[model samples]
Target: MSKVEDAVAADAATLGAMQINAFDANQPEPLFVEPYAVTGWATFIQRAASSRSGPQARVGVIRDDSGNVIVQGSRHSLTCLLHIARDNDAAADLYGPWQESWGAPPPDMSKDRLDAFFGEMKAQHKAVMGNVPHICTFIFPKSRGGGGWLTAPMTDLEIIMTHSTARGRGYGMALLQWSNEMADGFGLPLYLDAGEDVVGLYTRVGYVRQPDELRTSKSLVPMVRAAVKV
Candidate 1:
């Protein structure tokens, strides 16, 4: 994973809502896909037209538990993003029925609905960083690694969660192990902004916590770790 093998970019496909596409021929092919994340996100938007009570459209789910959180993406293929972007009423027709599901009153649909969604996506970008296409998502029994844009140097851990009912069972560590494996394979480092409670966790797991010198908020602790084994 340390040395780079040069490969030319051969094909690019459309991934829904992602600024970047996946399956870059130049980079290594991903080993698995996050079906839960994709289904979760697509269901959230698709059902938004019918019911707002539906679960969130993010993250790969733990089959044994009820918690899931996607970090930088919801798994919409570029094809999906373009489909919604091209049609004006498509987005509203998607998220409109779920308006009451929102905590506040719905926004004006009289304006561009796609723009409204993009606005929300932009806010998400601030939290997860720009569209990080290359990510390896895994949940216990099933595991798939690879599927990301090859341009970036580091891989984002994104959001890691274990249901309250499932905590303390080493699930979190298992997830970290998966991330480390990918980093080892790519010869890159892993980067994430650790929250207060998890700062100790990152330290114990081998992530070098960055100083708060440039911290925008007192709560966030930035950390990084070399993916390759020393």
Candidate 2:
């Protein structure tokens, strides 16, 4: 296999090991119990690595010297990162324009209206879907540096739980440490988003909460139609 392919294989092996460890230790439910999880994560890794974009993605798997897999983690470009800004103008713009253009009318709530609403929603969904993989990586990295002088260039992290039996062995920490080493190697600041429950985990590792990010969704049929015609 090519070097890149070898790396990917090694990474996948690490992920499998990590998952198996987590499962055995009863840390939490595994993200994927069936074949879907393994296939899905593999697809994501391949796509990210092949993409021609600014945020180059990479997957790292920990393995034994004999090439046995142990744990896995991934990183993606920062542009895909999503932040729910406290005062997000883009979201407001997307919904506000539509809400103002189409007032509350029965026809506005009719089947056609519903169709348009769904259409707009689909478009927004597509836009966001394109951003999910990369942003997800940024939010789940192993280590994040400080805001100013300590910042590093390679800043995104996403830890992948490939197996359930691999938890409680510090594999997660190892992945984060690996990512941090990459960031430090490149001299950049690391950043990630955490769910409310996992915020403490990140804090313990030097991640602090930024301003609370919010999300708003609204119907955008009229705007989309107008753009399409233009």
TM-score per candidate, chains pooled: 0.40, 0.43
User: lDDT per prediction?
Assistant: 0.33, 0.34
Residues 160-229, candidate 1: write the lDDT tens digits.
4332223344655655655565556655455555445555666666677655454444434456565574
Model 1 residue 152 CA deviation (Å) reads 16
lDDT (tens digit, per residue) of candidate 2 on 1-230: 10111235335433433333433234243323323324434544564458433344456554544554533343211111111111223223322332322233343134454356434433443343222221112222222221100111113343333333333455545554555445554444444433344455545554544432221223111010000111
TM-score of 2: 0.43
- For candidate 1, which ten residues in a row score worst on lDDT? 76-85
Which candidate leads the pack in lDDT? 2
- CA RMSD, predictions in order: 16.6, 14.8
Which predicted model would earn the best TM-score? 2
